[model samples]
Each structure stands twice: as structure tokens, then as C-alpha cells.
Target: MQIFARITSPATQSLTTYRPTPSTISFTVSTRPVPRTLPARLLFYLSILVRIILGILALALLWAKWRITFPIEGDISKGVRAELTTWVLGSSAGQAATRISTRLQWRLLIPGALGVLWGVCRRGYTEESLLVLSGLGIQTSTSSPTYLSTATTRFIPTTSIQDIFIHEAFKGFEVRFYLAIVVQGEEDVVVVFPNLLPRRRILEEVWRGARACLHELQPKSKF
Candidate 1:
């Protein structure tokens, strides 16, 4: 990882307000990044299934209404036009369907977001060392930032860091997702977060913190 850009003093000052402790840095990340273990992978896919089911149900409701409002005969009579208009844009059922779709989307966001937040709070970072990691997903304004679980904190000496790589690629929709942090002897830690900020900027900040520790260990970095 490289700190391509230096953070401005004013911007740094503003961010310091959130760092309650000295020499501490924090960021939100996902709790589970597409599990590698069999059991975890199964659970991850099961969650996807639940979301798919919800989406299918929403589409099915809309399709049912569409079929009822406009039969295959393709009638264009004045009464038929009125009924179609009511069912699609003006009827109570139409309104109900719209609300249901919105509600289901919100339901998916809740668990998906909360699970990551809970993980971060419990494992975001360890206090004893320079590296800190918590929950699973990127942090949210609604989450409690400092409520970290000490047990999950592991201190990897700055010298042990061989290379820091942040891999970014688009999953879809102009939103490039997935960030992976590959450590020397451990499994790669990959995270999936919303692309609110550019990925490079986030990586820069993370590298800045990690570098701070590494620089103290070795004034001249090897890589």
C-alpha cells in the first residue's frame, strides 16, 4: 500500500475529532467477505437465497397485477384502458405493491448492514498494536464507533508486513466493490463496501495509518 496523496492539515484536523485515542485510526468494513469456509459459504449463499426470494415475490406480485390488468387478448376498449390505468398507476393494489417492494428492499439492507456493523464493533481493531480490524462492513454514522471487542484484536508487528495490496474491481453499476488486504502469513482479508468514496482514497488513508507504524519500525521501508 502506498500513500499516494497526503491528507491536508485542515482535513486531518477535522477527522481527529473522531479519534478519541492518540495514534489510533478506524474505518468501517464488512464483517463477512464472501466466506471461504464451507459452513460460512453455505450461510452466505442462504442469505443470498433469502434476498432472491424476496425479489421474486415482489416481481411475481407485479406480474400478477400486470396479467390481470392486461390480458393476452390485447383489448384496447375504453373500459379496458380505464381498468388497466387503475390497476397499474391508480389502484389500491398498485399502491400496496409499490410499498411492499420498497419495504422488502429496506428489509434486505437492515440485516446486511447490521451484521457488518456488529462485526466491526466486536473486532474492528486491536488496541495493543498498530493494526486494528473490527466488524465486517464499512462503518455507518448510525453505528457506535468505539465499541470494539478486544478479543479480536491481533497485533502483527510492522516488520512482518511484506506487502499491502488493495484490489478493486467493479461488481456492477459503476460501483466498484471488493477490497482485499493480503498479509504475509495469514489468509487474505477481503472486504465488500459501498462505493460512496473512491476506493483509492480509502486505501490511501488506511495505508497512511499502517505506514505510520512501519516507518517507526524502519525509517526506510523496503517495499
Candidate 2:
């Protein structure tokens, strides 16, 4: 009976022996996110190209102005005559000079006129005031007949005098004169006197005062 029991136990132990099992997990692959680039690089390059083209055009214009030379021939007097004839006939030199002068005049006159207009318009007459500065001297309002009479008597006695130079600021002069006259209503007529002074010390003082006033009113610096 003991031998039979031992045989049965050995058979049970053999049935319970460990066996290896295959893993069920699969391997995972990680990928990184790709960075995107901006498209503004093309626009930047185009702007640079445009600026270079403009610079080249400007240089060409300057060269044309300087390189247009008239060749002299024959006697000195004859050569001068020939040169004058060529210039009158729109020679290269004449053309160059014309182009340069026209461009220069346009550049100078347009901005200058605009600046003058801006200054005049900016100083629109609202009330009577007096301004004294380094380059500009006493700018008095000429809105009233009494003020106009006083200014005329103090500066120009004759109405025929179109303009007068007044020494103002330290070493600057202002050209002062009547600009226009306006009739607002019955018994309400006003004369406008505009003063044109150098945009140096005299204008700077006024600008500073204006800036201060603006800051005080706005409580912030715009410039």
C-alpha cells in the first residue's frame, strides 16, 4: 500500500512541473514633432531687393549728372560757341543738368512749401498771444485793430512795406508781415499777421512750450 501511494505522488509531481509561456506585449515606436518655419523670409528678401534697386537708380542719376562732359574742338571761341550750341540742343550734359536740377528743385520746393503751409496752418488764429524766443523775436497777435495798428507802428509805418526783418532770439531774424484779413461778421473783422522765423532757437523755444502744454493737458509724453 505504501509503495502504491509513493508511485501516485511521483506521478502528481511530474504533472505539476513548471512550463515557460510566450509574452503577449508588442513593442511601441516613439516619433518626435516636426518644427514649422515662417514664410516671412521671402518678404524680407524682396524688400532688400527693392531697396537695392532704388539705390542703383539713384547712383545712376548722380553719375549721369557728373559724367556728361562736352568735348571742346577748334579755336577757344569756336569751342565755346559749339559747346553752347550743343547745350541748347539738349546735349548729354544739358540733359543731365536738367534732370538733376528738376529733381533737386522738386525735392526741395515740395517739402519746403508743405512745411511752410503746415506751420501756418498749425498756428491757426484762435486767440491773441505773444511769443518771444531766441531766434524769433516778439510775435504779437494781430487779430484786433488796436494790435494791428500797434504792430504796424512799431515795425512798419508804411502799408507799402511788404515785409520787415526783426532781430530776435540771439542771432536770428524773423520776417514779419501781414498775411491776410478776414471778416467774421458785422463789426467783427480781423487781420492776420504771420511771422516766418528760422527753425532754430526761436522755434525750438515755442516747440518746447507747446510740448509742455501738451504734456500737461494729456498727462503723457507723446514724443
Candidate 3:
């Protein structure tokens, strides 16, 4: 009975008695989807279009104002004086004053209008925007040799020679040649020119005058 039971039992079966072959399995892998690149291209083109439009407008406005002078005659000094006179006179001045007033108004209006248009158009381009922002409110003046010479001579009498030397040497070309003396304080004087160049002779003369003044103030000191 035990032998019959063993013969029927699965555990008692030998390795050679019966065997089943293993089956191989196959798998299918899905490929990943490619990313779309159209958005990036669209952004690049938009940026380029903004830059071109801004550049063209800025150039056109600049060209229009290139040879055109403020105050019509390029006489800023006279225009300023005339404008101030008109303001002071109120209604007393006659036809000449009226014509001058009209001209000044146009001079101011034309440049101001052009500037506004340029600013609006320039906002579109990144490079032009950067440049315009960087130079906002900055102005440049080119002084003739006569102006520099006259300024140096005129400044000496008003300022202490010592102060002038120290101011010129320490501050250099930054002192406003025209209105250095008229400025009330040290800081104002420093800020006025901020980019002026004094001649060597002028520098030496200022130094000598300052030293003499110092000697007069302190006779005991050799300086």
C-alpha cells in the first residue's frame, strides 16, 4: 500500500520520468514622443521683428532732427534770453517779442515731440532700449579754445586763487568753466562742470596765485 501510494505521489516521481520544456516570452516597447520646436522659433522671430521696427523708427526720427537746429538759428543763448524776456514782460512786449516767443515755442515743441516719438518706438528693441536708458538726461558740450581761455581768466578774479588751484587740480576738467564762480557751494561747483579740461598754463597760474594768497594769509608759513 505504501509503494502504491508513493507511485501515485508527485514528489516520488523521478527527474527522467517526465519533463515539460520552458516557453520563451516576447515584449513590445512603445517609442517616446518627440518634443515640438515651433514655440521657440516663434518667440525668436517676434523678438527680431520688435528690434527691427524700433531701430528703423529711431533712425528715421534722428535723421529728421539731424541738421535741424534748436531755436531755429542754432542760437540757444539768444533764444533762452528772448524766452525769459517774454515771460518777464507778460503782455508789454510787441510784435518782435511775439515772433521770438513763437519761434522759441516751436523750437522746444519740435525737439520734445521728436524725443517722445523716438522714446516710444525705441522701447520695442532691447539693444536700443538699453542704450536710450543708459544715456537718459546726459548731455555733451564741446567748448572752443576761446571759451576755455576766457573762462579761466574770468574765474580767477571771483575765486580765491588757492581755492581755484585746489579746485582745478583736485577736480580737473569737471568744473563748469562758464558758471563755476556763480555756484554757491563746493559741491555745486564740483557738479557743474564735472568734465572740463584746464590748460597747463592756467593750472600753473592758478597755483601761483593760490600760493601767494596763502602766503598773504599765513606770512610765517613758506607755502
Candidate 4:
């Protein structure tokens, strides 16, 4: 991730970026990731995909869990099972696998499904973003944990937005700064970067940039 301008706190260990354009201002914070190359990113996702596929295969195997001799004639069932098991799993390993599957039943499938779920919850880089569009509106979005899920987003039109400002609140024991947008009709204010909750300096920079972009105003002369 490229950080154009930011204020990092060793205590929080957050990565923040601010980008302003002629008509928009955007700010984002990421709590994960160490900056990867193109190939590395591809490989990272590929690894996660491979793990999910493996978990799926584990569950699929239960569906085709080698019926063996469950419905065959009593006397010849063993012989037929031995032949079929050997044909598929090859000699000793085949018979052993069938026995384990028969004994475990759903015990095996549950683990595989849980493994897949765990993979789905492992979000490599968690990011939260705030986007302000000059005459349009403002939006807040949180990146999804896994590739299977979509980002969570909310958009408030410019008309509904009453004001945007920073406020202080007790997060744990220390007071942290957060940006909030007051909506015209809503009882609760919408908080930006809810998860990341960057420092005040970063929030102030974003506040200024957002106002300048949304109002089409240039900074006053310092002199």
C-alpha cells in the first residue's frame, strides 16, 4: 500500500493513506499486510485458495466414502469389498481408509467443513476506507475478511449529511479520536474508519481535505 501522507503511532501499528483529488478526498487505514509484490499477492491468494480446495476435497471424500460391502451379500461381501477397496485405494491403504471412514461417519466431515470456514475468516489485510465525493455524497467501507465475502459499505448523500467532525471517546482506557458524520434525519452519527480509528492528526488532515474538496474552496493565504 502507498501512503501519500500519514501519521503512524507505534502503539496502534496502523498504516494510513490520504488521497485528494480535484473533486474527491479519500482516506484509508490498514491494520494488516506488510506490502507485497504483484507475484507475492497472487501467491498469497493462491495459497488460501489451495487450502480451501483441500478442505472441500476432504468433505467431498465423505460423500463418496467407499460403501464397500454395506449392501452386498454377507458371505461374499468381504471378498467384493476387498477387491473394490484395492482397486480404488490400492491394497492396504484402501482397506484402512474405508475402515476409518466407516468408523468416523460425520466426525470426519465436520472437521473439513470447519477448516474451510476458518480459511474464509482469515483476512490477510483488513482495511477500512472513507470516500467523500464533492457534490455527491460520502461513503464508508470495510474490507472483507476473506475472498468469498464482499466489502461492507454505507453511502450517505450530500443532502443527508449535516456535518462531519472529529470527536473524542474512551475506546479502552485511553481517549482516541474518531471522525463522524451527522445525518440530517438519523439519530446516530455515522463513524468513519470505525475499526482503524486513526490518530487525530490524520483525522484532521482528512477533515481539511474533505472540506476543501467538497466545498470547492482553496486554502487561505498563510501570509
lDDT top scorer:
4
Question: Which of 1 and 2 is ahead in lDDT?
Answer: 1
Best candidate, TM-score: 4
Per-residue lDDT of 24-119 in model 3, one digit per residue for the tens? 111111111222588877876776587566555444334334323333344654687666644543544333334344455456645755665555
The deviation in Å at residue 133 for candidate 4 is 1.1
lDDT of 4 at 95: 56
lDDT of 1 by residue, 1-223 (tens): 2344543311211121134444444544332244679999999779767655555545545554554445555445457665765557456766766555444544564464455445434422212212332211122222223464222334444444455455656555654533344456777553423223234665566556544533543345578
C-alpha lDDT of residue 121 in model 4? 62
- Local error of candidate 2 at 53, Å? 0.8
What C-alpha lDDT does candidate 3 achieve relative to the native structure? 0.34
**Model 1 lowest lDDT segment of ten:** 8-17
* Candidate 1 backbone clash number: 18
What is the TM-score of each predicted model, taking all chains together?
0.29, 0.19, 0.19, 0.64
Model 1 residue 40 CA deviation (Å) reads 39
Q: CA lDDT of each candidate? A: 0.45, 0.35, 0.34, 0.72
Q: RMSD for each model, in Å, please?
A: 18.4, 38.2, 37.6, 8.4
Model 3 C-alpha RMSD vs. true structure (Å) is 37.6
| Model 1, position 199: C-alpha lDDT score | 47
TM-score of predicted structure 4: 0.64
Write down the worst ten-residue block by lDDT for model 2.
10-19
Q: Of the pair 3 and 4, which is ahead by lDDT?
A: 4
lDDT of residue 223 for candidate 3: 65
Q: Give stretches of model 3 more than 4 Å off.
A: 1-194, 221-223
